[model samples]
Target: MTETGDLSTAGAQNGHSCCAPATSRAEAVDSHVSHPGADPAVNSESEPEFSFDFVTAGGTFDMGDPFGDGHPADGEGPRHRVNLTEFEIATTSVTNDDFARFVADTGFVTTAERLGTSAVFAMLLETNPGAEAHILGQAPGVPWWVEVSGANWAAPEGPGSTIDNRRDHPVVHISWDDAQAYCAWSGTRLPSEAEWELAARGGLKGRRYPWGNRLLTDGEWNCNIWQGEFPRTNTLDDGFIGTAPARHFAPNGLGLFNTVGNVWEWCADWFTRDYYQHSPQSDPQGPDIGDKRIMRGGSFLCHDSYCNRYRVAARSSNTPDSSASNIGFRAVRKAH
Candidate 1:
């Protein structure tokens, strides 16, 4: 039930919670099981070939706390219990270079490419528009988030823009369909909701921050997020204004990098407001069909004053077909 946003531009400024019951999710998975058909887990057969870092997480854990402290309205209430089996997730969000190879081979056109442009937030001031650059914006990031024409993975800034210099940064302005396409080609799949949450938590039981509560230990910055005023001044405390490299920050207790900040990672689950009310206790997937798809890992823009969802447990969603400049994805798969 959290609002939609990018943690990078909006730092401390972004985006949801959803848990469904066991019976419902179980029924949905079973009814919709279709064929168990192609072992979605068997990437050994794909030509694109994907290799996962494969972090191993196990044991019982508290899924979500609706009535816990500072809980949001839509995330759920009365908290819940869930047990996750063994699983593996990518160490970082899919990078530009990583995605480029997929497109170069498949000629995959991203949603932003197909739609012309995605939502881009205007994050800079209008002063000294003539300083330097090759775009028509006054500040840094698009502050207004207008659907400018000709914006996509190739043209992140807009019309005349290009990803030539940003091949190292994570690919943004992508939709759920785009993410799925990449995963399909890469021989990997999106992490399930339970798998995503467990990975974000990094095996920590109740600590807020990934490294065990205490956002800062002895004045040292932990995650990569905004430190100064949002949407205007960033203070560059994290040495980054927008999306930092996927490996910018330290890894969680599980040794997984960028669990909280940098970019909101897309997961394999459709969104439902009341799903968490009765979410399953063990490896719950999600509702059958809903409007929005699930996204996790609050980005670099998370802040308490506005969007403090950078925490490992926070979540949000958007239309499956929707794409934005702030949103991106990583891939996950079962271990052999």
Candidate 2:
């Protein structure tokens, strides 16, 4: 099955591309909610509204595909140096608990909720066969993606599943537009693609995985990604078949956690394959206008066999309005 491309473009050969050619550019920016589980009161007046810790990073780093074998469709090559200004980013992707609080306070409706549907992994549906009735459609070329009704952040697997104990896990089924709403309410914003790569590198230079070149070191898995196979079977060798806690793995040099896997974190940049060819050298902010938005890192669905986009330099994209079970986000703030 060939999944249709969104608004981003890359040079990878695999069908598992968020980095594929996009449709057409759109004018408006994207919106953020719709997680399950209740949240603690977030009192911005008295208590700190945003509780996640932030790591400050600033330096010049090569921000594109540092290696030759990476998905050229991802446009990861043409590795260029980018001088980034200091910026603070969340230690992890926004948690379900974090998003819950935003939902409780604002009563905001996520695009998934508004659309009354979101994409669910077919594997998940197989686990809960009852939900098969709710299947809306399948993403072309990616048959595993079942667009199921009621599969918002609240009910991740259509109608039967719940995020009950997964509150600390990164909230999924979030569109770029939904993430933006959460950021606005929390007094934060999504990271630019460059800022995201810089932070993901964790002070390292030209390394493949965030922890280094080795995907597994000392018989230990570094991040949450597909284990045995892609889409067919997940050995759960990483202790998780789906999303794990935001802080499940060890942090990188900058003290950021799970920047490479678990979920595809949305970025503020618009999607474009050639943007890197002429992007500003200092603090580049993506294209002036485009159809899709950028997504970085990768998700639990990512596997080296198919989607190796979990690498720091790899990128993918979707329309601002698109949301999926593996698509979540982290936020960023400029240092004062």
Candidate 3:
């Protein structure tokens, strides 16, 4: 039930990936396709308007899995204490509507849009003959992930899919670089790993989830994670098959919505498994350099049978240019 190896390595070893497909930009490129350059826009001088609700959080908190149930290869154990200054974090992940506004204002093109393809859970695609045409190929080892051409945030499932009715849903197919672009344009930044954990913990000292140690409270699902067998069957016990609304689930004690499940939220940290071994006690800003970036808050695809990263202390990472249908991000800023 518990995941043992890192997602990137485990996927290759067992043919089952955790959370989402973790392909790098170099791995995404094909000899037949031409990739475009990233958007050149920078942060705007004017204050950008955001409709998101922000929750203020600050204090000393236990930062890792206190129960010692986390994946050792992921560096989720050896629970550490961290102190954070006052900061504001978005209550919900960035919605399609929110990302739309950012694109409208900055004309920023996400990495997926530029590359002309992105990783999408194959089950999300329509069961039609033409659906196969949009699929470029399947991710190595993770056959459930199909690299679909034109599978950007707007058309999450490929050419025919649209975000028209899912505006309230968290925007997916977002890479770390794409998230950074949105942060720059919004005059906000991605939450550091420490800040993110504090907000996710809500006011609790150390618990398995934002709500408590149990996955369910009174037989009721607390968040939007997979309820049935993963990669093959989802029982829809949480009222969602793919991504849920950005504000679908109950807020944590800190008023953060879907902080543990819904979609994987990117953090402003370069990922390193051993960082916790020598991390700073105050405001540890991940490692200085790394090929991958941190992603917290396991996605709707998380299932106890395979990926139990929905737990509050669970951690994972992906390449900065990796974009997937289950990946999204929230913004944060210094609180006055």
lDDT per model vs. reference: 0.61, 0.77, 0.79
In model 2, the worst 10-residue window by lDDT is: 31-40
C-alpha RMSD of each candidate structure in angstroms: 7.4, 5.7, 6.2
Candidate 2 lDDT at 75 equals 71
Summarize candidate 3's per-residue lDDT along 206-299 as a digit string, tens digits: 8989999888888999899888776788889889888888877788888888998889999878878899899999888888777777899898
Q: Distance (Å) between predicted and true CA of 71, model 1?
A: 5.5
Of the candidates numbered 2 and 3, which has the greater TM-score value? Answer: 3
**Rank order (by TM-score, best first):** 3, 2, 1
User: Regarding lDDT, does 1 or 2 come out ahead?
Assistant: 2
Give the residue spans of candidate 1 off by over 4 A: 1-52, 66-71, 124-143
Could you tell me the lDDT of residue 61 within candidate 2?
91
Give the runs in model 2 whose Cα sits over 4 Å from its true position.
1-48
Candidate 1 per-residue lDDT, tens place, 190-301, comes to: 7777677777777777667678777787887777777887656778777876677767678877777777777777777777667878777777777766656677767666
